[model samples]
Target: MNRKDQSLAALVAVIWGFNFVVIDWGMGDVPPLLFLAARFLAVIVPAVFLLDPPPVPWRTVAAVGVFMSLGQFGFLYVAMDAGMPPGLAGLVLQAQVGLTILLATVVLRERPTGPQMVGVALGAAGLVVVGFGRGGHVPLIALVLCLMGALMWAIGNVISRASGATGGLALTVWSALVVPIPLILLSMILDGPGALADGVAAFGWKAAVSTLYTAGLASLVGYGIFNGLLSRNTSASVVPWIMLVPPVAIGSAWLLLNEVPSTGELVGGAILVFGVLVASRTNRIRREPARQAANSVGEPNLSDPTPCTPDLPLPGTPAQPAPAVP
Candidate 1:
């Protein structure tokens, strides 16, 4: 990637890392379900007008919307409200990548390389270090919620890959449009007008800013850029950069929320990075050979679509094993 792209990617990373801070802040003012409902509502207005259609089928687009937009945020918002720390929320969310990898293997039937297998081992070990190393108690309900969010996200990744919805900003917008109806209904059924009124009455500039940042900038712009990277780059090249979010999240938590990572979290972070690198290394190596040969022949190879698809292997799916390359 060029310096400019790298800079943009870093900016997105920062936005995403800070998203937890915003989420935490918003949760204080709004109920989790209502917060998600409002956030997604904000998404619909701008997305309807500003975004273009993704290049995928409508079914694929709707699936992406359900998983990535609705389910992921729904579960995550609930998880955070249920006491999942924002800093760790970011780290645990990285588990989505691993889940995606596993799901892709099953649904897409793609096989992982040796490096990826090593990554799985390393990442699993790191989780063990993080989960059980310290005298920390993992919240079962919160962890389950996060896993649900990851599954939703993984399904979205597969749908994106299957449909080749590499339209980036346009696709993000379209996907954002998917869940307004359900969210509105959910808000009515669960939160009720009274609760929502309370939230709105209590909503200050801080809450408003957090909502806008999360829905508009973070989800919209961040995903836009992320999809751009996925569309233009290989999974090996792009997926691992996601691993950067955890440390950034930890730092953001410390700086913003004064939530410091425990010693075990630190150790787990290191392990997570190591594992992601290993899993990504094989794809990187394979791409290198092909890119070199393509360069020699004066032709660019652009076969793989965005890695942000719902086809990524996730938990709760059978291990069907995909090929090395998508």
Candidate 2:
């Protein structure tokens, strides 16, 4: 990633990191799936009509919404309800980093270099340190659910990367249309109609403000930028930037919520940053865009209005466009 994009990714991570504090603070007695439904509902209104859908097939948009937004958060909210600590929830969620890299290797066949592998390993170590440092008795089901969330999120990452669609706003909003109803139905079923009704009855200004921030900034703007980054960078190169999130979350909690970071967390935060730097290599290897048209991460400047075409051919591979949106 270039300096400009790296900076943008950092900013988005900070917004997302702080988002946890806001969500926990404002959630009150609202059901998690209902809260998520509200956020996505907010994401769609105005924006959906204002901007056109991404220039991809309807199925592509739906796939992203299913795995990335609905599947990821559905498992997470359920896991948290099953008694996962919010701090540990944040930590466990990032398991997607390793998952994304591994999936990219298997599916996309985008191999990471040795240094990149080491960087990813260091980042994973940082997460482990952070997880251990923030000790909690994790329930087995919640742990499994969280891992499922991570896997869904990783699949979403690869889907977005494969789509090669760089217009983050369009993809984020249009795909979001696939979210609210199913989640609302699930919220009603799992959380019960009474719980959902009660949660809505109790919704207040705190929840509203939280919803605005989460829906407006975190969901729409944040993911818009994130989707673009995925299309513009390799999954390995882009995903590790998320390691910064836990540290930022901890630091923000310290500053605003009076939750001081432990010594281990501090060390782990440093390691995460170093790991991202190592993995996202400062010197980007740029590839000249084919037909001077918009394509993969190598030529970050171009835009593909027609959704995706192909990844740059791997060395010695046939000059055929790679598979996409499967």
Candidate 3:
């Protein structure tokens, strides 16, 4: 990636990192499901009318929408509202990466690399530590919900991969259309009409600004730039930059929300992050033979040829995987 694109990718990371704080600010008196519905409504409107639907089958779109958009954010919003701090939410949500790997192993029958196994173990251990550290600061149910959200994200990642769609933005925009009604209905049913109405009446500038940042900047702009870079560069180059997100989330939470990580959270989060990094490291040695074979035949040898695994978007954003083309 060129410096310009790299900078753009970094910017996206920052936007996504700070997104947890934005969501917290936006919640105010709004019901979690209702707020999520509004956010997705913002994402789909105007843009959906202008953009063509994604080329993938409607079933794929619907599946991705349900799991990625509704399931992921539904659980996350509820978790946060239930008292999971934004900083820890940001870090814990990344367990989706490891979860995806495990799911792929079971469903797709892919063998895990040693590093990946170790990473998954380390990440799980970290979560256990985080769980033990919860005490009264964080709710166990909230942490469980966040982990469930990560699992939903992993399911969505699998769906996106199976769809074989290259147009991340199109998929994202179109899939968003599936979210609002169900969420609103759920809000009405679960939160009750009275609560929903009161929350909407109480919605203020903070809610509006938070929705704009989440729907406009984080979902649309962030995914736009990140997917654009994926089209022009290797996923290996682009994906690692996502590791920057947690630090930014941690720092932003401390500064903006005045939230501090407990010692357990800090230690566990570090172990988890390090485990994910170890797990994600590609086996260059194993790929050298393939590279040599391609070179001998005069075919172009990509420095990083692994299939791009899409990262789960922050709450309110759809997951956008890069094209599998080498």
What is each predicted model's overall lDDT from 0 to 1?
0.71, 0.83, 0.73
Q: Against the true structure, candidate 2 has what lDDT? A: 0.83
Give the clashing pairs for model 2.
232-297
How does residue 180 of candidate 1 score in lDDT?
68
Per-residue alpha-carbon lDDT of candidate 3 for residues 102-143, written as tens digits (9 for 90 to 100):
565455434455665675677677766754554466788998
- Which of the two, 2 or 3, has more lDDT? 2
lDDT of 1 by residue, 105-165 (tens): 5665445567766776777667666655435555889989988887787777766655555
lDDT, residue 321, model 3: 42
Q: On a 0 to 1 TM-score scale, where does candidate 1 land against the true structure?
A: 0.78
Error of 1 at 288 (Å): 20
Give candidate 3 regions above 4 Å deviation.
1-13, 109-112, 115-135, 223-244, 262-326
On lDDT, the stronger of 1 and 2 is: 2
> 195-220 in candidate 2: lDDT tens per residue?
99999997899999999999999888
Give the C-alpha miss distance for residue 37 in model 1, angstroms.
Answer: 2.4
Number of the top lDDT candidate = 2
Residue-level lDDT for 297 in candidate 1: 51
CA RMSD of each candidate after superposition = 10.1, 8.0, 10.5
lDDT of 1: 0.71
